[model samples]
Target: MTKHEDQRLRIIDRRTLWNGFINLEQITLEQMMSDGSTARLVREVHDHGRAATILLFDPERQMVVLVRQLRLPVFLQGESGYLIEAPAGLLDGEAPEVAICREAMEETGYHIESALHLFDAYMSPGSITERTSFFLGRIDTSKKVAPGGGLAHEGEDIEVLEIPFEEAIAMIRTGEVCDAKTIMLLQWAMLNRAALSG
Candidate 1:
């Protein structure tokens, strides 16, 4: 932030509210107003660190590999928790590329030679502290070293789905594919399909 922006807010205290699978922090601070005044505010930030997500596409087949798995949070919201999404996982102190590759092997059983780095994004900035690195990778069936069904111990009973590009995109339109990360990656592929094929 700029020097003028620095005058905007002051942090009074920061405390941890909860720390488990996810960390929650309460920040007591004040923000400056346009009228040269400050407003006190307390904002809670859910810190889950960062993550990496990779969209694996087959240029020749014009298909993508996704994982269908249950999300408890979604289920608790009275919706079907089975979500189709790109391979993703927490960084866990590893580099984004390394994390994505590990998650890919664990979830889909594919060993990728390399992946193209896309961008970094905040899934939900309103209250979450997660910033996910995005990537794209090209793969074929020949690269499958094992049956891609996810790890058993992690409670990951992932159902690997390989669908045509058009079908995957259509699923988004009809609400079949509702995961935000998956949707974003699919749209990106659509825009860069020709380049990817080359």
Candidate 2:
């Protein structure tokens, strides 16, 4: 790798603060020699670190569970004020499986089995340091019900909805499934639905 790439990887500054989030230092661009090119902009982002999310699906029932809640960002964007999202939460020192299972129970009121990690990636490279680990979980249909509201302390008022697999896919096509993570998870489920059903 070039010197600029190396510099970008290095953390030049870091500040830890309250409110459970840290602000990372800005990356300084540097000039480096590379194969036949103008000066490259070498800058790195300080991220919010890793998080975990789950797509709770019941293979036997051909249904996937999602939650609806008001998202402030969408609200600011003049939306109708609710977003459909997967069951998710930050790692907060817990393992991804543990975190997702707990989130499923807390957010949906269903005792979910351990989840399988599908993949992990950055949410938005442009500005956010939010890396989310996406998981696939198996839930029983008998447990499917309204998740009720979320923790009032956190200002979360969530409503759980268990939609049929085909209907969920149709929603995605209709642009109703807007959340990136949820979309990705649903696509993954679509690909594996048959095998998962067997």
**Best model per lDDT:** 1
Taking the tens digit of each residue's C-alpha lDDT, what string does model 1 give over 98-150? 99999998899988778889889999999998999999988995568878788
**Residue 105 shift from truth in candidate 1, angstroms:** 0.7
Error of 2 at 121 (Å): 1.4
Worst 10 residues of 2 by lDDT: 11-20
Worst 10 residues of 1 by lDDT: 1-10
Task: Give the distance in Å from residue 171's predicted Cα in candidate 1 to where it truly belongs.
Answer: 0.4
Model 1: how far residue 59 lies from native, Å: 0.8
Q: Global lDDT of each model?
A: 0.90, 0.76
lDDT of 2 by residue, 42-91 (tens): 35555676788888788877888898988787889988869898978888
TM-score of each: 0.94, 0.81
Clashing pairs in 1: none
